[model samples]
Target: MLADFESKHSLYFDFAGARPLQFVNPPQQLEVKAGQTARLLCLFTGSPPIVSCWIRNKEQIVDGPELWTENTDQSSSLVIAEAKPQHTGYYTIVVRDRKSSAQHTLTLSVIERPEPPASCPVISCVTASSLVLTWSGPCYDGGSAILGYAVELKEQGHTEAGDWREVTDLCTSTSYRVCAGLRHQGEYCFRVRAFNKVGASDPGPVSPVVRMEQRVSAKPQAGEAPKRPTCVTMDSSNKVKDHYIMQEKLGVGKFGQVFKLTHKVTGQVCAGKFYKGRRSKEREAARKEIELMNYLHHPKLVQCLAAYDHKPEMVMVMEFIAGGELFERIVDDNFEHTEPASVHYMQQILEGVAYMHEQSIIHLDLKPENIVCVDTTGTSIKIIDFGLAQRLDANTPLMVMQGTPEFVAPEVISYEPVCLATDMWSIGVICYILLSGESPFQGNSDTETLALVTAAQWEFDEESFDEITDEAKDFISCLLNKDTRRRMCCKEALAHPWMAAFDSEDLATTKCLSKEKMKRFLARQKWKKAGKAMLALKRMALLSKGDSCSSPTSPGEKSPLSPEAKHALKSLEQKMQGPPHFTQCLEDQTAVEGSSVSLSCHLTGYPDPEVVWLRGEEPLEESSAVQIEYEEDGRCNLVLAKVSMEDANVYTCRATNNHGETFCSAKLAVKQ
Candidate 1:
């Protein structure tokens, strides 16, 4: 067979001198500053007519503006011009022939510190014993999260550098209250410094001197009558209840609850999203979503009818679609799903996405659950859920770390700048699942799923894609490319061969696709969603109850701890005795290669704390080789079945409850 193939196509191969591809000089990992150029060169030995290609995030690279490639028979070079933070990721060089292939992978890190605060700190409140300071965050985060702020204080009339002292090394929030060392009748100046993974930024401008006195008051002007205090009230008639009659609950979301509603005047039925929290921050976030939805107008997109601000709560009226979600229809026994059907849905999704892109909008969350049908027949489709949608312009680039792990784009997982291609990646995943009835990147846990996405580890399984056409697979591959630059845009995807053949009268288009795998996928998604929703609601309730621990003792039966303990015991005393605290923290350990290892810690908190294990910044989830155990008596353990060099890192155990949260970290060393 080999001789026959070589004889037939002798021009593309050298059968006599062919050698397996080998990398003589593989590319090395790189660490470069943003805006700097980076180049990766690889030299290899292979048969004649060897082909070399560059890939990043599973996407093949070609000669382009930002990224360009140069290749010869046995060598390749990938040059990244004016590399930005978004370009930080893994890059691979592959040299291959008809019979053999060699590849090398390397990571590129872009380092930069966040900018200082936008403006000088301001004094929000001044009291006799404490001073409250607030400042705006930096305009640019330098491609990483702004972990916290550092507050520094300098007493007035002090010129020496030693006069300035640190108020707090880490202030997670933008506002900080200085009550511990502040003294009455003292004057001080404050400045803030923002920090991220890279390091702390330059200190912002110093604030105006704040004079703390025993009392602050202003006297009325002489010969002038004192003005009466003005009062404002909300009109009861303006409440959402007065305009709409809320009906049965439809669904619950992270930030709000959806309900079926009917307009009182028009008697038109619609869906209303009522924010779950009455706090000002939650209401503001709800208002932002509603405003964005109302501003966007399209047939394929859900429309926001009206918005109502009823005091501390916000309600948004949305178009009510009778048909269920996209996946629900796919899993329905009565629904006839075929290659053409999947294409039909994907075309509609592409059209909606194209419109959003034209309007500078990117729907960060574009999963099967967010796409719904117009009616039971499933002819028309509407893209719902704008909770994570963002608008990006020429000047503003958004970096976010929030999305469904299974469908998130590689850049999102890396916290890189998001582009229109980000949504296209999710669209590709959706298309893959629509035709195959299986998710390409789903794993046993979120951590694993995210790892799969970052690596772009997916393939066309024979079992799932046996009947799938090459055109369909090509379409999905174009969108799922890890390199956002190479990924297809909405218009390009809509113009793909598979989508163009939506109405074709062919076997591949007419054949019914099996739904067995899809049904299972739907069931698994529902189960996971249920668990997450329950946890979120529980956490919300706990947080809303304030930062006080519930006592373990029942009323009138306390033997005694202290008056402070008795006072801390609120209404729900049976749930807990006191706030959570750590009895012991994790310690550094050493283990041999391929050996089982366990890290144990002791925790004691009222109302049982929720524990999370993390390796570096990445979370560790329960898997075949990983197991987590906790006991009623505050015993916690993390077990690893087979340890490897990759397991060597700083491991952290974070425990959280309504009362407070604490964490401890230790290093793990693995030896061969």
Candidate 2:
């Protein structure tokens, strides 16, 4: 029984090997343009089961939505419905089974769609009462008469089916204006459809609903203070005051006052800021601040709960923090053990600051006072007061000097092009205060502090920071660099060894310290092997082309013999020979206006050469006007229909196979 099984396997292998292991179709000669469809056929036969693949160039076109297939006992065909110029390349049919395999190559050519004489442009609503429409015109169509266009309108809110209503007719111009006189509070929808002699196509998608309401005016009410500062309140006389007198006063400031209040309905504790006498400018700023806060949703940032215009009062409600500001926790004498408590707290602050920087937001006023520690455990910190914050794009230059005197970066003080790196500088100062229990640089007055920062003179007392790890010192030193260019960025700072304390306990200890340790550890060894292999290949290629008189001395001197090398050599030789030839035959080929045309190339070559067609330097497959056909004798014929001025270019036919490759060219002229 074993002997019989062995004989059967041998016979199966012989049959598979004997059958031609080759792609049956001319995979290279077909062409199609973008937005056009092309079909590819894979023909093969075998006694044992065979699997097939359609590959573009050499890469397999895996089964996907764009690639569909139909299989039969004799052949399988792949249909690509919308071939794009990106699809232009050499295609191959690969057939294989356990015993043997075969492949055939074909080149694909894609053409550009003809420019339409009149385009049906996209339409949209610019405002509630007006609709804006745009379109592109065709390049050439005998200047066909654009009698007019048909505008359609339909309301999405209509309960029953609604019929489209055509409005004013449009001329050859590419734009249209539509005005609505509907209900002031009602939303209306509109769309535009184009028409010509051929007939009208489907209408475009409906435009966004436009309302007919007047723009709401947001102005400060009378009896309000001029500066309605965020998180604070003020009286009509421009002094700190609370509109809701019952809520306990938490703090007072120049522009407003902060009140700890409870929601009348929800009974939830919240902080309220009321404007004393709202100036128009201050009211506008308050309005914008509310809009900005409404869109922001982050865990580390204080949430703006609500905002309202209470006639004579402009109020902003916010989440109340119980733990008070980081400033109080670090500076208050009662919190003497703040150092150990601040280690974890400082980490959370850095995390929140890093998040803001990632969002392209610069908390220009980043200081201990602005950072509120909400959790009673003192482990959480929330960045507050977006009033001074700005969404900074890379191109924007710092135009205004902002932030506290001590924590502000030198560039910010200098009114230079400060970026997110400025925030990093502030974070560094905060870190120093948290670790050393004192500010890194200080003075009795703002003027003295500015002088100290400008001079860049500060002492780092090693004794005072004995408990702080050297890693932390190095991290701070890198971040505190006065030169903005040299300052450590948020991402780089986050990746520093000191910041990796949570990843490994030993990382925070000095025992693992070594000069150039991270550099040597992260270096790759695989790159060395890759370099050696590349050098060896280059040496072999050079020796192969050496003078015949020179004798081959070493085994390495001999050309490396591999399956891939042999296959490449065979392929190169085949491409040198041209395609097979056959008699040229034509029935009727003519160029017509608003129509398509075809051109054919018939040829013959030995060893069945592969066939491909090209117009100018580009392959021509799926062109609205071009079609290719392959005959039994290996001859290819190209067909170009409704040929236009763009089609007037030299065309070529190329054929390549295992034995050789060749090509032929012809010119197509469009008659006036």
> lDDT tens string, model 2, 1-672?
433433342110123223443444444467554577878776765432345555553344656798776665357677887987667555655555333455655656565532332334343333455545544333221112233356666655774435656665454344455565445566656655545444443555555555545322112233232221122222233321232233788876444677886644345677876655367776766666665553344567787665657555676777888887765554444443433354466667666666555435677777666788886555577887776676565445664455566677766544467777888888888777656645666665455555466555576666557666777788788778876645776656766777655453432332321113112212321122323433433343344336223864652122232343334434434433443444463333335544555566555443445455666776655545666665432345676666677777777776554556556676666665
Model 1 residue 321 lDDT score: 81
Model 2 lDDT at residue 503: 51
TM-scores vs. true structure, each candidate:
0.48, 0.40
Best by TM-score: 1
* Candidate 1 clashes between residue pairs 3 or more apart in a chain or in different chains: 551-576, 552-576, 552-577, 580-605
- For model 2, the local distance difference test gives 0.55
Task: For residues 1-672, write the lDDT of model 1, one tens digit per residue.
Answer: 434433342221123444555777455668777778887778877553456666665556757888898778668788889878778777766554434455567777676788887668766446766866766666556655567899999989998878889999778756677887888878889988888778899988889888887322211122221121111112223556766788999999787799998877667778888886477778667766765663355679987665667666677767888898988987788878888778888889988887676545789899999999999984689999998888675567798756777777878766669998999999999998999888998877666676678779999999889988899999998888887856877756877888867564774547788989998899888867634533433343343234224544443232322233323222214323345577888999999999999998887665455677778877776789988876534667889989999999998887766788788988999999
Taking all chains together, the TM-score of candidate 1 against the true structure is 0.48
For all candidates in order, the CA lDDT equals 0.73, 0.55
- Candidate 1: regions farther than 4 A off: 1-237, 506-509, 530-672
Q: What's the lDDT for residue 32 in model 1?
A: 72
